[model samples]
Target: MTDSPEFKDEESIRRGQEFINEVYRKMSRIAEEFAAGEINRAQFHRLYNRYQRQIMTVSQMIAESDPSGWETAVKSDESTLHIRRQFEAKAIGLSIYDNRTGMPIETIGDFSLDAELIVPMLSSYRQATAEIFQAGVRSTEMENGQWLCFMSGAYTTLIVLFSVEPSSNRIMLLDRMHRDFEIANAEFLEHGYTSADQLAYPFYSFIKRSPLDTQDLETELDE
Candidate 1:
């Protein structure tokens, strides 16, 4: 078996300790995700164990370097734990679908999915939602880690494709945007929304809003 890494200098020890602390921070986030129901128990268990093992391996490396390395890390533990971790999910695409016809009213942004493929999936989702507990929002992560945010309104459904799992704040903004869309186009939607231009596309501006801002839709920047 190979021996653990040894660092003779303070800078190397500091960098190694930083890595260990970074792993700790990741473990902390995983725990938070489990608590917030963002991750299931199994996922949390796997991620937690992986991070834990990584920390162990790295800690051994650093310990074999400077016996005081752990002591140095301990001094800043509280401050490191208190660091706020911000999550940003990139907006990949946005689509508005007519609930009655399962037809897409508008689709824009950088998504690669054809409307043909999405319609059947939306149908299945709607059927399942009708049969099961239908919530205000449905966030799904694909096998490859792409995130889909589905927000339904009275007249239409909003489908947002995201680069990664969005935060609760971003999801809330989407929910608000869907609600606003219904209200903004209430007249046209209630009567008959013949064309995408007939309704005001509130989400049009949101397409440009990437890496999601901390501000909400109501406080959205005017462009």
Candidate 2:
């Protein structure tokens, strides 16, 4: 007898839904356990915070219309961290960084920040945004049958690694993901932090496209 494909199209959709449902169930269980005094308040807070962050991250991925799939990690400063929710058999890891200092507070595992990886990832994000605005096409490449990536925005990028099957629909996925990313980006901008310079590199210098004007925030507040 021949073995079945790792995922049929219908099965893929079903599994995607199942993964999301499982994540929800896990988060709910954590919340219930915390409420029942099985976990301490601090533990509950950490779990809840992680859940919130994961939801935001996952929402971006979903909005970007990713097909290879995505997962999130939420780590804390302490050593007793645990994965409160996992959607797939694939690994999910998190590294918490001090927003003020750009220093890592804690990393769940070996989540190294690679500039070579990040540069292309950021480029993909820019292309995604441009495609959405112009209704153009997008594509992605799989390296050594292992990694797949689709960019959602400047700060958020989705990376999926193949454990079972290699990504074959990367181009189609990238195009569709870009559409979803556009909608998510619009919503993200409405919540503030739209400029890349503002959120990612507040200290970097750039040649302005036009003359810089002093915003109300730039004006000094009267004591």
The positional error of residue 181 in candidate 1, measured at the CA in angstroms, is 1.1
Best by lDDT: 1
Worst 10 residues of 1 by lDDT: 78-87
- Clash numbers, per candidate: 0, 1
Give Cα-based local distance difference scores for all models.
Answer: 0.70, 0.42
Q: Mark the regions of model 1 whose C-alpha exceeds 4 Å error after superposition.
A: 1-30, 33-62, 67-87, 132-134, 208-223
Model 2 has an lDDT value of 0.42
User: Alpha-carbon error at 133 in model 2, in Å?
Assistant: 70
Per-residue lDDT over 1-223 for candidate 1, one digit per residue giving the tens place of the 0 to 100 score: 6544543355566876787788889888978875775644445555666666667765775667554455454454333222222124667788888888777887778767876767777877787677776557887888788788887777888899987676676677778888988998898888766487577666666676433344654477552
Worst 10 residues of 2 by lDDT: 201-210
Model 2, residue 22: distance off in Å is 1.4
Query: How high is each candidate's TM-score?
Result: 0.60, 0.27
In model 2, where do residues sit more than 4 Å from their true spots?
1-13, 71-223
lDDT at residue 181 of model 2 (Cα atoms): 42
In TM-score terms, candidate 1 sits at: 0.60
